[model samples]
Target chain A: MGRQYEIPIGAQHISLLEPLHFKFTTENEKIVATEANVYYVHRGIEQACCSKFKFRQVSFVVGRVCGLCSISHTTAYSQVAEKLLKIEIPLRAKYLRMLVIELDRIHSHLLCLSHVAENSGFEALFMKTMQYREFSMELLEAVCGNRIQYDFSIVGGVARDLKPQVAQSILERLKKFIPQLDELMDIYKNNWTLSLKNKGAGAITKEDAMRLNVVGPFARAAGLAIDVRNETEDLLPWKQVGFEMITETSGDVYARNMVRLRELYVSIRIIENIINGLPESALITETKAFPDGEATVRLEAPRGELFYYAKGNKTQILERLKIKAPTFSNVAAMAEAFTGNEYGSAPAIIASYDPCLSCTAR
Target chain B: MNKVMTSIENLKKDIGDFYKPELHHFMVMNAVEVGDQIEVQWFFSDYAHPCDTTCFYTLVRPETEIPSIKDIVASAWVAEAELVDLMNIKVENTQKGFVLEPDFESGPLRKKK
Candidate 1:
């Protein structure tokens, strides 16, 4: 090693959104080793869910874990809680849950792509992407009556019915977004400047991804055919609503961006199908019984597979609640993938990984 | 989900026999405090099969030294470290000041009488 140096970033940094720290050991601008700390924002939510919140109300509490994938947390908790209660929600409720989830995924992916552009020193592209992303946020606000913490998903089912006018507006907006998405796809796929910075940066192989138990787009970009949506058709009817797995082979930042962009097309199709084939049924399955057994639920959050485990004693409070976020699984791969990249490219690479520390540290 | 109970000694053999990275994806290592002992469960998902989950667990005291499975499963370190900090799980060579503050003497997850 020629003139090795230890460089520390975050716990607080401009490029990072959450309090995640990484100490990179670099030699001549190439990262040789990386140590990461992701617990800066850990807030005992699991313990609170077990002790403070009742089993029925824990869904809302878990929803606060991550702003981006709030619905994922709530929906996962609801599913696990449903299993514990041994109650089956209506088909309409399940489809609505899938609806909000796909909407959330669209915005979350766009936000990540924008950050990648921003961190890659392409501020103009970042601005352009964010401008395009506004539609999803507005749509989410219209759908759930709130922008961030949707509070849309409850224990048995969704909170509100999808009014026809709102559904019509959603279709109109989605129709408008397709052209914009296509434009973005073209830019991200063909732009020479972006390709130069992201084509080979932060690449991980399929074998390494599988070894590290990587999930979501990061693993999908590396050619790993792993998705909770693909596996769990019992909980949510993803396939009935036209769910398709999107993958890219390169496993680099560029490929990741491509995967996210293309997945938006899939999301759009799912949303349309959900609206067109919108089932007519009760929004929730009311349960007077308390949760009474151990249950595990796996959901495909925007980032990756979000796992929730809960145990109940036929009482109001849950005996135990454990949440394993997507970023937790990606931590090893994140550190390993940084080994051969330049120090300056760290921000873009980190953004591309889409490290969700709030979810991880919780 | 199929759950099997294993001892500390047989844990390695059980994991070795059941786990193949290509076939089964290791999901998470979860620990829940049962009455007095801690119930540590290792969860895995079938990559080839549809919605099949295998869970292997061991009941041990908080002070018992748990073997690190990082060598067998590369991604075990993170969850192993989390259990160390949150549940006072005695996994050898794993750091504790993760998911909790460094000065905490005991895990917060341990129920108080």
Candidate 2:
């Protein structure tokens, strides 16, 4: 119905609270192309890591890289330094690490689901998601002492040990969340407007997804069955704690939503299993320091694959520290996926990826 | 073979045949007064693949003759240029002098004397 139009959205807006801007070039209401302005608030975390902190101090610094995936950043840093130091963490420590990471996944995904419901004008559904999210958040606060940025990881092992009472409390809360999530899932699946808005709105083929190398929920939505946690078996010891990697062949906004929701259940199950067989040992491993060498570690963050590379010269200070976050890698694909989609669905489609721009920028 | 031996052997095999040919690609590589210079490691990536970590040593100061790896890895182009600009590492036959920002003299990472 139209030839050309310019739709300019902000680095900040009412619905999309994060500092990210998108300018859509459109024909009628269907977006033909899009462009983005990134690094507007680039805190220069990498540069700061290289210059400001000594080796030990960098862990605490990078943990503040992204609030939502603080564990992922810290875990990646710790794991890389562990390789450099040539020290193997204790068995109990490894399981605890997995438990905390699964908890982070649950914590992040619930917030994303609620945001989606809120954006779609489903007030009741949004409230339910928020209510369910509180249980996870409360458990996190009880375990790690802070709900938002849990500085629970140190160089060799975890910062805090899980007391029996705390573990039991978390277990009970997770038990309460399972049936509530299932009920919410039924409502989302049946909602006509929600399905219509999400389904096939931002579809990308499997081949394109592979070429773009989308990871996490976005990759799963494209039917790629790759999960770093499953691949790294020594990290997770439990047997019956099962999680089927959820995927949707449609590769649309709806598929992404489905993948995230299903993953929520898997994360809760993983936590339950960890508590059932909590290991016995000291939480912190003996630390020497990072040696004169370079180490790189890859971990599956809630968004996608996170890579942390560190170079140490056997000194207290690190020579180089580089972080490659998921959003940076997926930026191109996001632009491609949004093309030809209706401009009205732009906010919802972008929100479907549940982007944490802080993670991307840092 | 034993577990340790097998891991060592796997690593040796992973280094591949080009270990000798590609040895001369590093320059101005060493830790600055960080105890002893135990080893210098190299993180190499081919035109199409991800970077693979390798090692260079003090005994054989890797050939500093060749240009930096800007052609092979696109991302490292800016990084290497910045390194040269800041650290004053004289990379021979290097094209395009500065990467971070020209006229920005004095290194930010160096310890104040």
Error of 2 at B95 (Å): 16
Give DockQ per model, in order: 0.82, 0.07
In model 2, what lDDT does residue A307 have?
A: 68
Highest lDDT model number? 1
Where model 2 places Cα greater than 4 Å from the true spot, the runs are A234-243, B1-113
RMSD of each: 0.8, 7.5
Q: After superposition, how far is residue A328 of candidate 2 from its true place, in Å?
A: 1.5
Could you give candidate 2's per-residue lDDT for residues B6-89 as a string of tens digits? 122243343344232222111112212223212222332221222232343222122232244433322233334434544444
Model 2: DockQ vs. true structure: 0.07
The TM-score of candidate 1 is 0.99
Native contacts matched by each model? 0.76, 0.00
Residue A54's lDDT in candidate 1: 85
lDDT of 2 at A213: 52
Cα lDDT of model 1 by residue, A1-362, tens digit: 69999999997899898789999999999999999888898888998998888887888899999999999999999999999999999999999999999999999999999999999999989999999999999989999999999988899989999999999999999999999999999989999998888999999999999889999999999999999999898999999988899999999999999999999999999999999999899999987999987999999999999999999998899999999999999998999999899999999999999999989988
Predicted structure 2: lDDT = 0.66
Using TM-score as the measure, the top candidate is: 1
